[model samples]
Target: MLLELFTGKCPIDECFSGDVNLPKWVQSAFPENFMQVIDSKLLVGDVCNEDHDDGDGDDDDNLYVSPEIQVEYCLATVIEIGLSCTRDSPDGRITIRHALQKLKNAKHNFLKNRNGEKM
Candidate 1:
């Protein structure tokens, strides 16, 4: 569920034929090409809503961490939880309660990071 939520891919996605399911597909892109595997929408950060530029076409010298990066960190944490839940052995997998707590932490951290950056 976490993998599907973050990566925007399903186990039965058409691209996942043969033995390649959502978890494997995401794993292949892990640790390096993760940005490619995740939902591109998450990175846009309001490119469609309005122009947030300060006319420099660059960083604009803002001190806050961009929302895009925060989402990426949150996504990475969620994906890790998904992978942990899908481990080959039941012993290796995290319990549902544990996963829930970790997810809550990830969300808390994401919100905290965003709030901290703004202040």
Candidate 2:
């Protein structure tokens, strides 16, 4: 729940719904402007509402992304996220830190569970 409220990644249904264990200082690192490109509507304005049967099939050209080109998209997004959050605003910095700590806690819990270690 906290992660969803903070990360703003994925759909609301896909968001993590659990209490975040990040400290106040760490939670303050992530920026409040965090955004995720879930739908292409933001990229191509009103494109979804356009007529597709106009025979241009060139509408396919507007849809540049191919499911088969997964590797390129995967790496690009990974790099993009890694380099994102420049902390241009104070909220940005806090959001980054909070999201980072939240992710760290999730990783820690996963490792402990896998190793049968107590946390």
Candidate 3:
């Protein structure tokens, strides 16, 4: 649920081929080509309404996050967590407590960076 919120796409909808699973598809693009896998809609800053344009020329503030380094770090952290949760071996999977801790740390780091705090 959280993964979908962050990624903005259903894995089943994006990677539903017989030969590939969502995790594999995502893993293939990680570290080197991670940006290619992110949702483009999340990068848009402002959206214009075609039908309700009153010629006022005001930009509509849509929900968007910049692809800055800090944002990328946060995204990478979440992706790593997802990968950990989806591991083939049960022994390799992380516990819910550990996952939540990781997420909290990632959020903290992201917020710290966003607030101009040194690491």
Candidate 4:
């Protein structure tokens, strides 16, 4: 689910190579070109853009949340979680509890930054 959010590609539909999976593909490109792996829509801040017509045939009201540093941090956190969860060895993988905690922390930080609260 997190991987889908970042890459905007369904793993079952897009990643089919026997030698590599979605997580591996993301991991390989993350170190250098992380933005390239992210969904273009996300990079363009399209998720929050809503088109609403205000009676007068004027579609001037558009709501958008521009991508910021917090977005990058959140993406990085989720990518780390995805990588941890997809480890080849079960022992190397993080438990659900740990993953949840990490997610919560990321969410907290994102919200904090969004609110302009000091960390």
Candidate 5:
């Protein structure tokens, strides 16, 4: 479910017709580098542009919340949660409560880095 949500690819997607299902595909896509697997539509443009004036009307190049970095961090965390949920063995998988807490933490951290940027 989480894989489908973030990847925009259904569990029964044509790519998952063989031994590689959605979970496996997603797992292989991430772990090392998840950028290749993330749906482009989910991440586009900057969270907030640097066009705003800070009293002096000069360009403020100090904003550290880069769109790429912010989105990358959030997506990585999300994919990690999804991968944990999709573990082969239920005993090794994360609990629903644990997953939810991790998700909340991811969101909190993601937002905190956004610097009040709108989605």
Candidate 6:
């Protein structure tokens, strides 16, 4: 469930760890910290059943995050990451599609590792 928009991989182990000790560019560019801020407001019972370990709630578990929130978070992260890259690169720009593809690759690798599937 970790969502990020970095051109490179995340350095921390946890999705919401929000370790700010990394480079400033990463801190500003990734959505990890931003997501942490949003998640911190969740009361004990506010989050979806699946997000919690208890998982006994009757509500459907299909949608842990609403589509609107997902879109906003994703876009913010992409913009920040793109800005950082453009700042460093001579081209001074990035495409939304490419940024999203990087996120997809990171998620695929993470899921494969978690599932204990060998490469």
* Highest-TM-score candidate: 5
How would the candidate models be sorted by lDDT, starting from the highest? 5, 1, 4, 3, 6, 2
Instruction: Give lDDT tens digits, candidate 5, residues 1-119.
Output: 78888898988887777689888888887877677777878777656545443365555545545656677788899999999999999998999999999999988888776664433
- My TM-score estimates for the predictions, one after another, are 0.75, 0.23, 0.72, 0.72, 0.79, 0.30
RMSD to truth, every model: 5.2, 17.5, 9.6, 8.7, 4.0, 12.7
Residue pairs with clashing backbones, model 3: none
Worst 10-residue stretch by lDDT in candidate 4? Answer: 58-67
* lDDT (10s digit) by residue, model 2, range 1-119: 33323333433343324542222222344333123322223233321332223255554444333322222233233223433433346554446665566556655654453343323
> Deviation in angstroms for 15 in model 1?
0.7
Model 1: per-residue Cα lDDT over 63-86, one tens digit each: 455666677778888888999999
Per lDDT, the best of the predicted structures is 5
Task: Please identify model 4 stretches exceeding 4 Å from their true place.
Answer: 14-18, 46-67
Candidate 2: regions farther than 4 A off: 1-94
Q: How far off is residue 93 in model 1, in Å?
A: 0.6
For model 1, the stretches where C-alpha displacement exceeds 4 angstroms are: 47-64, 117-119
Clash totals, every prediction: 0, 16, 0, 0, 0, 0
The list of candidate 6 runs beyond 4 A from truth reads 1-90
State the weakest 10-residue window (summed lDDT) of model 2.
33-42
Positional deviation of residue 33's Cα in model 2 after best superposition, in angstroms:
28
Instruction: Estimate, for each residue in 21-47, the C-alpha lDDT of model 4 and write its tens digit.
Output: 778788888756676788888777423
Task: Score each candidate by Cα lDDT.
Answer: 0.78, 0.36, 0.69, 0.73, 0.79, 0.43
Model 4, residue 18: displacement in angstroms?
4.3
